[model samples]
Target: MDSADANIATELETRLSIIDTIERDDPSRRELSGADLSLFIGVSVVIVLFGILVLAL
Candidate 1:
């Protein structure tokens, strides 16, 4: 194959390898308990309120 064709093949192989690595590292599923959900929402609300207060200043 030509130099350009070889470069393209190499690029494709690099990209596919990166994708495989990411898929392997990523979580398959997520599970949260009631307290975890509540805390997340509570923190989110507090952040939003703080942002609004800062903007009002």
Candidate 2:
């Protein structure tokens, strides 16, 4: 039973490592670009300002 459990754990780790490597290599999985970051920040600032305005009124 212990050996079986160990084998399962090892297999799981191996599969997870393969998945991680594939995901890292995938071109579609990209980090935020400069335009994306700017848009996000602009939207966030607008939302915050709107919230503050609502609270004031």
TM-score of each: 0.45, 0.49
Best by lDDT: 2
Scored by CA lDDT, what does every candidate get? 0.86, 0.90
* Model 1 Cα shift for residue 15 (angstroms): 26
Clashes of 1: 0
Off by over 4 Å in 1: 1-30
- Residue pairs with colliding backbones in model 2 are none
Worst 10 residues of 1 by lDDT: 22-31
Q: For candidate 2, write residues 1-57 as lDDT tens digits.
A: 699999999999998887689777676667879999999999999999999999999
Q: What is the lDDT of residue 4 in candidate 2?
A: 94
Task: Please give the TM-score that candidate 2 achieves against the real structure.
Answer: 0.49
Across residues 25-45, which tens digit of lDDT does each residue of candidate 1 receive?
556534576998999999999
Estimate candidate 1's RMSD in Å.
Answer: 6.2
Candidate 2 Cα misplacement greater than 4 A, ranges? 1-27
Q: After the best TM-score superposition of candidate 1, give how far the Cα of residue 33 lies from its true spot, in angstroms.
A: 0.8
